[model samples]
Target: MPDGDVNAHRRIPRPAWDVINQLALRRCTDETHSVRFRRGSEITRWTLAELDQRAVNLARRLHATGVRVADRVGVLSTNRIEWVLLDLAVLKLGGVTVAVEPGRFEPERVIEKYGLRRLFAEGETSRDAVQDIDSVLSLTEPPGTDVPELPAFPGYDEADICQIKQTSGSTGTPRGIETTAVSVNSSISEVQELFRHGDGDNILVLLPLWFLQQRWWFYSALVFGHDVALSGYEDAVEMAQAVSPTVVMGVPRLYDDLRARIRASGAPVDLPERRETIQALLGGRIRYLWTGSAPATRATLEFFNDAEVPLYEGYGLNETCIVAKNHPGAFRLGSVGQVLPNKTIRFDRDGVLVIASHHPVNTRYTWCNPGDNQKVWLPTGEIKTYDLGHVDDDGFLWIHGRVDDVISPSAGPNVLLPPIETLLRGLPGVHECAVYGRAVRFLTAIVSPNPDLDPAVLSDRIVALNETLRPEQRVHAVIVAAEQFSVRNGLLNTQFKLKRRQIEERFARELELVYDKHNGDAAPPVPPVLVFG
Candidate 1:
């Protein structure tokens, strides 16, 4: 992806932070109510003035510790108001911040590779992960730390790398994506304008602060003088009753779980009244719902649509920023909405989606695996998104599949994963599964059945589930995996996500026999090297 010509993207720009910083100051002095953090039975809030003063105190502490401009820092913690304040404090000092996903983050590797000036984690995090660096400190001070007076933060500019997003790689480790201050500010502005976000909106925060989908909303709330309601991962329907948020956003899993829970209750999922009941469970004031990170389940989407819930889908990566999104008056299911305003999209000769925008985007990578750089940012200021997709005649983008996810064989239709994997996950006896159809005779899958069920019985259940599929979509054979993909097994990313390519490699030999049996002239013997029941 090359910048080609930036004519379509050029806009008169100012740093988004400085402008929003001023807004925070104004709101604080006006005593405007700003944030609400939820605990078991308590909803604590802070006025802009109180929030500003606390942030200033934290900034002074950071400065006291010799934090300075242009230094890279790492944050490994969960979502909280303090996370945003620390992030803003970093930006104020012209330092760069990196998010380390706590569940799967390798703290020591990040500290060495990024040469972090400091690392911040929740006090509750394992001491082993925090290590013994003087730079490793709790995100906030305990009862005994002293604070001295300090001057106001001078703030940063386009040249300063304000944040680094660690992209999980196929190999299980992650590479850092550097985002400049200008890029972040412009993204905040664009998202605010696109969503028509204003000061009056009460946003319900669901995703963790480390994720771009959630992190940007925190920035938006600060910029627009809105309120944020932090909810934990639980029954969102129950959580909504506590917060009464006007908008809710999360990954596809959050909604999928809600749909499953509703169906289990024997409630109707298709009728208009049922949709309203689902919405009511979420505090009854949701203007629209939004999901990203992965494709939404068709069942979840259809369920919400019948309930008249507007669920928008978006597509982007850390390197490319927000590429395209579905929104009001312009949305299509199975499509990732329209190309966002001011962004230009085109497909390469290889059918890979390429995005170009003039807003000061990320320029380079830090600690990327070999050959991964080709898929990140290029010299042309364009992002080479390896995701394969094309723009429709109506200007919407539909993802075809990843360049590496294809399972093309000698004489059958190719199989694309996720769609296959997600379907398998819905079957009763199936606990976990993955599909591989590349260069084989037909589609085959590796499965981990529920632990409580008999192995042969579960395999038979999968065979029955396969009959519900079309010829190309059907799984002709199933390999029973010895265990579920997990962090301990080195198959799941730190975020507990499947590193599909890695999983395939780990089971390469086992799959060869599975595919051979499905397409072989003779009934193939069960894999001897594996624990196939």
Candidate 2:
């Protein structure tokens, strides 16, 4: 354990570990209805004791296959009972579990980064890139065989590494973010303190457990001895009704989709019966909703407020494990809450956010690339967050956008593209917009105009709208015919964050022509320039 020196993040104490172990043991006994999930039309329930024993069995099997303490084992599957089982088993045996996001598998990179010795798949489709793995294990029964029996393993210490989560890799290549058992326990404790839960609480999980954020909720519930309800990829209304969870965690977009669906279906968004059901599940649960992984829009926040359900929003990254959250007594509708207890947050001269907390710091895992640390750190001890935001007078935090996207080249004053785009996207004719500056001189916008609007009218209206901006911030021209930004098109990342560099690279030729036209070079004699729209 690192000493609590000014230079080092403090380590977890022994008593915390003991408490976690005892909690896990007690919770294991209550597993009779600990987990409930649906397979087609069949509903399966498992007690906490059953889950514990299954994890022990899986741990023994994994150890027999040469897994050891600190070794990385990868699970590439969707959310299911087996996923949690394998995860707990790995943790119990002192092995680190790395969850592979569905549809975002990079086999070669996984092997190279994590040195995974064993890989588990839920189905054959998930084994598409299994060639790099040393051994592959199936969670379900093989074609003609029953599920393989796993052996039990000896006990594990609380200080052992539990999981190594890969960063979302929105900026560059991904790197393994190591999380120790003690840190996970601390995170779980923090959650239990803020969001009260008990054995009677029934929680619903919809976000992919592979995400570090969602995993916190899972462990928190488990630590609090709460029952967990799992659902397949179903519509929001079905999930809400079937799970009847008192507490739910979802991304901003998911909440938006749910609100839209509930409204469109004309279902009672906040029926008293459903509210009471949710409240009972959380042991008098006061709040039933939370949004993260991206900014929650004012419209989405107000939707829940109007429906009379308590929805709190928070902000964090894989590195810090949810440092700030909005609690029932400390929530502001649009803010991402205040800086959490025992954490310090500050801003640099350029307005980029920085965070320093008790969470473990990874000196070896380089997720952001060769110069990532330099980009996210200053000469001071704080870690550069890359996010741009400010704390309000009342201590609420408001994240504006990424500092990288808000560029100020020597040619002009600062230009914040994201905020501009946010406003533009809300305009009547605009569908989506990506604003970027090129060659340090001109500003350009790659826009996907609303399909329902007339193209000629939209183009003309957009041109007229640009006149409202200062000349430097004005759009040089609008690329109106471009397709909607998507991951498959190399325009969005796995987290649905826009890939600005990719979009710029894809539109290089058109940008060059635009630059030339502005610089007095002969303009290309073309109209309705497609530019691979």
Candidate 3:
């Protein structure tokens, strides 16, 4: 390890290599430490000691089932205490964990692809889906009644691949990203150093446990002697109010939806009153809000800022965990804060972002196409992020868009799509949308408008937006999709980012008709838009 990394580890109370031991240490010293989980109207709390005991007992049960070092054990469930217990048990036994988001992807395919020795799935529906598979186990069941005791903690190397996290699959299929104990611990330490989380800090995790970041926060709570409340996205608002947590991490879409609801409530015009209203809506205890996973609108950012709400945006990838972040101590609008310590970033000649760290999460993809792996994970231990971005003089990072997602029309100049898409998503009645066209005569979009948004009103909004863009960048027409883009529909990934390829494929005929009608036009012109499912 680099000297910098060695020094960084000093902030952590115990070495992360033996994370279970570290949790036990916290349990010994901090009897008040606890992790809470919300299920319906009831909340479950587990002390550090309880958490450690359950995990060890569960590990014993797993060992009886023949689970061993390096076995790929899978967990399919929503955000729950069982998910955390199973993950800890797997790691304690020196096994790899493949946490699949329940119902997002077919459980059978994940099990087959990863060659899982055992799959612990939750819910009767999920269990029935793979009842014929002998390897499948019940995730919701309590730890077995009788199990052999662990004579001693399992032995393993910190560098061994311990976890496989799935990418958001926005551009293509979700690939498994390998992570090691050292990397996971390094990330947790870096975050703790940045925030200095301690007593009185209660974190509410709203994202699914399948997300690696969420799990990292859970581990941080165990190591740092703080409190954590886990809940699914549906109850995020209610849980926040119920728990009065000091920290909440969410994506831009969730914030946008909250912004809509807050606006619908007609916040007070008085500045102080508005601030109080917004804070109360979020449980009145949020010290700061963390958002990422997608670009946030300036309007949304400004709304929070004007109300004195600390909504800090950050940037990172599944490959390079948490490259940059904005915090209360340091923040900048339109930038994902400064690049975090212990990581170095540079832009390629094409302006694509590249990052390197002494303690990287992983150097390569464990489950992805060979070509895809070659393009992103370099032989030099650097992760090549295909995102176009640059650091300002102050060192804050600003993202443009993906190089592959850039739009290039045959007749007009090339243009980026995110800036335009961000503007459209900010408009009322627009749920989600995607701009599509490559080497084509004109640009077009497929929008999923809210049910109440009038067709004429949406057309007029698009026409108004086009007037602000260059001819090549203007969206001449759009197909208003009747169904919204969601995880169930396969138009979006679990992280709520649009699956561009899937969206374009779903609306191929509409796009062809759009070009056929407007191909002859010499310049950008607003035309009658069609609404379809």
Candidate 4:
């Protein structure tokens, strides 16, 4: 589709490579001393020209190692200047960059599945893993290795595939999603329109760069000639105070942590002066705050809304590259926003959300198998999003949960798990809760109590929490497990999201006993020998 017709449901225009090139050229000539970081006793500044040169050098070095166009080069490192440089370098070489989120996956698992040939590490610890790579490039000069230093290289066309980011794989195995320079440019345009970003705007990037959404914020700011402030390994609160960014992007957990910190500091929650301080600190110059990667809780939304900061919650997957997003002007508290101009959305007979957009939906770097690909239909040549949601009366889109996760029993209507889980997590003393309907009559819960408080206190808290829940939505009883749900235990995927199927299967026997007892079909067997911390 031509760029102009992207919204008209036509083919997306050819990729635009000049966007980054122009930024580099202008940075070389004009802005020589833009401050990138500002913390007490630690300040860093870089000119566009310097960044361009470094990116070119990194690209040249990568190509010298026999990397070619469309090759999947994995980068496993923390957020830093090198991470950005490697991304730009990959774009310059027309290679696909697969960024691994920190602390999410085992090194061996990442290598085995992704077939990573080359890797860039931030330190020795990261470099020690992944033995299959032909070469290891250290951004921080880890000791005792023959890895080459980054070099300068030339640029490539904007139409080239720049990055191949893996899906969060919160529910299943991770799949690489190919994003072309053209699609990225389209994404930038979409964000610019959605957020109304313009020149002189400062976008604070608090989330990790490996997250595809954060990449959108970075590109959008750069394409619009807005200043980009990056926080490296700093706490979210400290970053906010130091950067004083006009725009901030975060997940629900990040916002919740910030709110908790603010409240714990004895700051008056309802004071007008404190509210103004927060607005200026986080949104003063900021026009909007964006949250996603998971659904935002009502409490998080209310906290920000009461502070007068517009929280634009969006919805997308790696496969589609942000098909839907809420705009500041068209904000809705519980909705993920309307479909993007270039996309079409509708519900399947089962209430699964589907999307159709102009960009090519699949690429060689990441191939959705026949089974999975079949779920994303091109009935009218539009890619169907497999999520479950509905367009409300006001034309806003509200996502309930995944279609596959809707639990229906012979006794009643299907129960959506996400909303219920969100409500449960919001209750006092509840750390994390996973809801799954087992057998026919019972909804079971596997809960983790907050370690900071006593178990006796948590039990009382859960009782109070139950009062706020609908009877059917409430868990019959809670199991205070010693271990937290995590990817390492196969209970969660790398994105820190619950893997319901895995959790259920792992504890199937215990759940069966619970179900049989509750239904009065049989006497309850002895409780499983589960340990509690």
Candidate whose TM-score is highest: 3
Window of ten residues with lowest summed lDDT in model 1? 522-531
TM-score of 4: 0.79
Residue 264 of model 1: what lDDT?
Answer: 60
Which candidate number has the best lDDT?
Answer: 3
lDDT by residue for model 3 over 377-431, one digit each (tens)? 8777788788998888888999988887787778768889998888888777888
Residue 380 miss distance in model 3 (angstroms):
1.3
Question: lDDT of each model, Cα atoms only?
Answer: 0.66, 0.62, 0.76, 0.61
Per-model TM-score on C-alpha atoms: 0.82, 0.77, 0.88, 0.79
Model 2 earns a TM-score of: 0.77
Tens-digit lDDT string for candidate 1 (171-266): 456777777666666667666656777666778886667765576666566656676777655545666787677788776766766776676677
Clashes of each: 8, 5, 0, 19
Instruction: Mark the regions of model 3 whose C-alpha exceeds 4 Å error after superposition.
Output: 1-21, 24-30, 103-112, 123-146, 154-156, 168-171, 527-532
What's the C-alpha lDDT at position 87 in model 4? 74
Q: Model 2 off-target regions past 4 Å?
A: 1-27, 31-33, 38-43, 102-109, 122-159, 168-170, 231-237, 259-286, 364-368, 377-381, 409-412, 428-432, 439-444, 447-490, 507-532
- For residue 480, give model 1's deviation from the true position in Å: 6.3
Pitting candidate 1 against candidate 2, the one with the higher lDDT is 1
